[model samples]
Target: MLGIAAAVLFFIAFLINAADITTNDVFSSVNVMLIGLGLLALHVAGIGHGRRTGRR
Candidate 1:
């Protein structure tokens, strides 16, 4: 669930940044990168939990 939430957030960030890329805002790009990093962290955490619980 957390991973899924993170994925959604990352997608939203991408969409927002892509829409405003024409303006070339550095802050927006940074925010998107941060969102992507957060998503990665959530995915890693989910994988770790699955491995520890030995469940599908």
Candidate 2:
């Protein structure tokens, strides 16, 4: 799910920032954090959620 993906992104961003890695512009921790925020927002807005079946 997107929520899971967002969590992974947040973790990656945390690692990047904690590790002090700043070599690439695209993979920058801040950018990844922002992306994670976007995903979180989407998750909050009920996007990318799996549809549930009513009964078996």
Query: What 10-residue stretch in candidate 1 is worst by lDDT?
Result: 45-54
Candidate 2 structure, TM-score to reference: 0.84
lDDT per residue for candidate 2 within 1-56, as digits (tens), equals: 88999999999999998989775899899899899999999988988889965698
TM-score of each: 0.46, 0.84
> Which segments of candidate 2 are over 4 A away from where they belong?
52-56
Q: Which candidate is the best by TM-score?
A: 2
lDDT of 2 at 45: 90
Tell me the tens digit of each residue's lDDT in model 1 across 1-56: 55766677677677777786553565575676677677678777664344365568
Candidate lDDT scores, in order, read 0.65, 0.90
> On a 0 to 100 scale, what is the lDDT of residue 4 in model 2?
93
Clashing pairs in 1: none
Clashes of each: 0, 0
| Most lDDT-accurate candidate | 2
Worst 10 residues of 2 by lDDT: 47-56
